[model samples]
Target: MLFKDQVDFVRQHIKKNKLRVFMTILAATMGCAFLIVLASIGFGIQDTMRKEILEDQVITEVEVYTNDGEALDISKISAVEHVNAIVQRTRMDVMTVSQLENRSLEGNMALTNFAEEQKSNLKLSEGRMPTKDNEIIVGYQFAENLLTDAERNQMEQNIEEEAEPIGGYKESLIGKTVTMSLQSYESDEAFPENWNFTIVGVTEKPAKDWIVDTNILLDDSWKDKFQEVYNASVEGENPDLFYSSSKIYTSSLEHVKSVTEELKGMGYSVYSVSEQLEQLDVFFMAFKIGLIFVGTIAVLIASIGIFNTMTMAVTERTREIGVMKAIGASPKLIQRLFLMESAWIGIIGTVLAVIISYVVSFLANWILPMIVGAALGEDSFEELSMTFSLIPWQLVVIASVISISVAMISGWRPARKATKIDVIQALRQEL
Candidate 1:
């Protein structure tokens, strides 16, 4: 028989038992949808984590660590191929008190090279880079945390009472000369000489909302002057024990791997965000495969329904099969018709399953964040970019192939049974 005739034959039989076919398709739909939605959780979480890592770190930046106690040679690192810039920061161990008018704040002080910082595209919220050794740049939250003694006391009291704390200094810190006093770590006594620096700029805010950037960045030229006071305060301490952190930036993200390898070859320990992402991808790939394996079990369970339905169809159409055989229809043609009907059921069910999966994914992504935020008693989570469920095209294709293949396999035994039906017994209505 022609393919069109075979299709018509299958359609007529399916129409005769509409309710049974509908239920079979429903089972298939539920199975396929479950698989997609279950595996989507893995995909969604992987995507969210990948995005967070990318946002929190500079992909092209490689952190260089010295293997020995010696400091990193900036000149040698800068000479490497594809190297864009190098930013080295030396943190002062002494307690630094920054005083602006009547308000003062104790914060971390780091000496850095302004030239290298400019090359690394260090962002500023206001004003320009420092042009003199006495000029410095502060973090975005520097002004906010610079509070007076009375305000600090009030803030402490409010914290104890679980009340909203008073605000900090509202005035702009740009072009302001701030007095910095280094205090001895062993004693509360301030050093005899105080260093005065002009605030030329405020660094850009951090990527995370919860991170407070209150660090102060001074010119490397002032490192010696600050070190002298720090060394004098701690007479027996070794200044060489203090290590500086150096970060190397590549011209582009594509060059990070090569640059990192070269730095490692030079006997320096290097870490890059790209390396972290590579590990993350490998982990998620295996995790997603496991989730898919678990989800396939649901589809297999649904296949049982397909098998039963097809078997019933063969039994019900035994007489019809005998009549077709008596009229010269081949066994293979009969089998093909049965298989086609099962495939049709799979096709319809898979299409519907994809639609349902997408709807569920959207709803989950939307509702889950709000639900979690409410449970945590924090509204900031609602603003976070998080994915709870995701369905990519590749997942849909995998599910379709699995669903349709299982349906065909389920119908195979029943289709073979139809081909072996005894024409004489079926025609006579006898065993």
Candidate 2:
């Protein structure tokens, strides 16, 4: 028979048992929808986590660490390909007390190269970079941490009571002159000479909300002056220990891998956010596969219904099958007709399921964040772009293939049984 005739034959049979076919299709739809929605959770979470990781740090920046007691070779690192700029910082070993008017606070002091910092894209919230030896840049939270003696005592009390500390210097600190007094760790005495610094700018805020940046950045020229005081305060101290951190920035994100590999090969420890993301992708890939596997079980269960429906169809049309055979219809043609009916059910059900899954995913992404934020009593969560369910085109294709393939397999046995019906016996049966 022609393909059109076979399709019409299947359509007539389906119309005869419209209610039964509808329910079968509904079952298949539910199975496919369940699989897509379930697997989407895995995809959504992986995407959310990946975004969070990328936001936490610069992808093109690599942190280099020294091995053993060795010092990092800046000249060698600068010579590497795609290396745009490098920022090196040396932290003062002795605790320094910063005083501004009646307010005083102990702040971390680090000497850094301003020229390299400019090349590394160091941002400032206000003012310009320091040029003179006495000029310096402060962290975003530096002014906030500068408090009077009474305010400091109150802050400590609040901390003890597990309450958020409030009240800090709110005025702009631009062009303010502050005095820093270094305290000797060994003798527990303050250095007689105090260094005065003019605040030229404030560094940009950190990426994470929880992070508090209050570091004081001075010119690398001060390193000699600070080192002399530090050496005088302590005996037999390794100078290399003062070199706190070194970071290398690539010209583009694509160069991060090459720069990191070269640094590693030169016997230096290097870390970058891009490397962490690579590991994260591998882990989530396996996790998503497992979810898809579990969801496929639902489609398999739905296939059982298809198998039963096709078997009943074969039994009900036994006389028709015999009549077609008595004429000139081949066994393969009869079987094909049955298979086509099952495939139609799959196609219709899968299309409907995909539409439903997208609607559900949209609702989930929209409503879940608000619900979570309300439950946690934190409105900040609602402000964040958090995805709860995500369905990609790849997922739709996978679901369609599985649903349709299962339907065909389920109908195969029943289609074969229809070909084996005895024409003589079927002809004698009641129509």
lDDT of each: 0.89, 0.89
Residue 229, candidate 2: C-alpha displacement in angstroms: 3.3
Taking the tens digit of each residue's C-alpha lDDT, what string does model 2 give over 6-107? 788889999999999999999999999999999999999989898898777876799999866687788898899999999888886678788999988787
TM-score of each: 0.91, 0.88
The numbered model that scores best in TM-score is: 1
C-alpha positional error of residue 174 in candidate 1 after TM-score superposition, expressed in Å: 2.5
RMSD of each: 2.6, 2.9
Q: Taking the tens digit of each residue's C-alpha lDDT, what string does model 1 give over 1-431?
A: 88788888889989999999999999999999998999999999999999999888777799988866677887888899999999998886677889999999888888999999998888899999989999999999999898998999999999999999786889888889999998757688888789899999999888888899999998888877777766775667555524589999999989999999999899888899989989999999999999889888988998999999999999988888899999999999989988998899898889999999999999998988999999999897878899999899999999999999988999999999999999998898744
Q: What lDDT would candidate 2 get against the real structure? A: 0.89
Pairing residues by index, what is the TM-score of model 2?
Answer: 0.88
List where candidate 2 sits over 4 angstroms from the true fold: 1-8, 185-188, 232-241, 370-385, 422-424
Residue pairs of candidate 1 with colliding backbone atoms: none
